[model samples]
Target: MAVRTPVKFYYDILSPYAWFGFEALCRYKKPWDLDLQLKPMNLGIIMKESGNTPPGMNPSKGSMLARDVQRVSEMMDLPYNPLEHFAKTVFIRGSLTTLKTLAACQIMYPDRLEEMTRQSWLGLYSRDIDITDKGNIIQFATAANIPDVDQLLAFSLGNEARQQLITNTNEAVESKCFGAPWFTVTNPKTGRREKFFGSDRIEMLGWVLGKEYVGHHPPQ
Candidate 1:
């Protein structure tokens, strides 16, 4: 059997850029011959730990990121309408729930991870629903086949889940993560690791993989 190349993604739903990057990955993955692993981490926590401000937060950037999000969303063909005064805590809800979904993937349904990743992103960005809202969170979880919605919400709110999120954030920080849409790719055959950041770098990823860049023509 051939071993598939593994790509590790670390992101937060709070980031429209990350959403854009993930959309690129979804588009180019097959041609790249990759096995994508979605690893959810809160960029908010990473920023706090690293003492870095998000680009959207900088008045100097002058709404570049906000506007870029809309441009990239249209280019990628994924629906996106960022919420106003976006609640930061909602990322925590997603992080914890994503962890639970990943766990569920390990035991029985390995495909659950992909399902949850797509559903959660669309729920937050496409559907434009507030994930911090309990009902919406449950709706996302249910769509992902996550068992026990109330329990998942409780865990996400409780100390343990928060700590897990913190730990994941710290780990990403230790990895020198500056923002969302950070990726760590491991060559399964030779145990090599490469890091790539940003949606624009998706073509570079294809270059590294010795594949044609098809990011401009997204899959229908």
Candidate 2:
């Protein structure tokens, strides 16, 4: 029997690239014999501690990133209808509520984190919904049909969720993570842990795992 590779996927839903990366990793998980770990972290804290400035912070980079996000979505064939005045509203307002919900899910519904993440991504990217709002967060959670949702909702709004987000963010920073969609893949045989950054690194991750690099868009 082949040994399964352990992959720790650290993501922040605020990033379109992280959404794409999460999908790509999920698509390849079984084929690559992976033990995928979904880790939700606070990108704001990661950026602050890692001394990394968001591309959106710069006017030119922000414009380029917006276009790049569209192109990547097209390449991956993912839905990405961003909210109006996304730069001013979504970016400025941040995704604390959504992140807290994901963190709470991590604690309460570990098995459902991926589904919740997918729904959260769709809420922000596909539906153009502001997940930062408490109402929207609850709405999305209930829509996802998560188990113990009321308790989950309360947990997300409490101190437990805040601390979990902080702890996850701190772990990412400790791993030298400067951005979201960061991955730490541990080779079971060699006992080596490798860190990878960005959605573009999916191909390289396949190479590292000794799996076929079938490009970004795999057949549906």
Candidate 3:
């Protein structure tokens, strides 16, 4: 019997790069022999714990980062919208709703977790909807054919899932992941480990699955 390796994907809804990677992950299935785990976290808390400031607060690097992310989004054929509102405001309201909804989806329909995540990301980044709006959240959930939108919403606002989300965030931090779109690949057979960050390195995901990479290098 072969042990299947799990690929843990750490993401935050506010991250455009995570959206891109989430989309990419949706396209690959069992041929890769990978178990995908979606771990949502409050990126702000993670940054604070790691002794880093939010990108939008760093004047010198923020603009450069915006351009770099936009370029990558274009390459991936995904939309990149730099929120006009304050980063903290967006993170507090929008990301929390999205993450909690994701947790609910994970609990209710584990098989459809990837699809739900992709749709949620599209609603936020591509459709430019107010993800925090209850109506919009339910709309996204229903569009994905996720049964019981009201039940999921109840779960999202409930104490249990929220606590689980916090625990997941802490686990990511303990694993030394400091940012969004973190990928952890461990071969269960031999226990080989590989970690990559950002959607730019997603091609490496296929490579790690034993897919031939003729000539590919990590994006700088």
TM-score of each: 0.79, 0.92, 0.85
Which ten contiguous residues of candidate 2 have the minimum total lDDT?
Answer: 82-91
lDDT: worst 10-residue window of model 1? 100-109
Candidate 2's C-alpha runs over 4 A off are 217-220
| Highest lDDT against the true fold, candidate | 2
| Residue pairs with backbone overlap in model 3 | none
118: Cα error in model 1, Å: 2.5
Question: Cα lDDT of model 3 overall?
Answer: 0.73
TM-score: which candidate is best?
Answer: 2
* lDDT tens digits, residue span 107-185, model 3: 7777766777777777776776777788888887888888787888898888877886897788778877777778788
lDDT of 2 by residue, 81-126 (tens): 7568776655687888788889999899888888889989998899
Model 2, C-alpha of 50: deviation from truth (Å): 1.3
Candidate 2: Cα lDDT at 102: 93
Once superposed on the true structure, which residue ranges of model 1 sit more than 4 Å away at CA?
Answer: 87-110, 147-164, 187-192, 218-220
- Candidate 3's displacement at residue 26, Å, is 2.6
Give each model's clash number.
Answer: 0, 0, 0
Clashing pairs in 1: none
Ranking by TM-score: 2, 3, 1
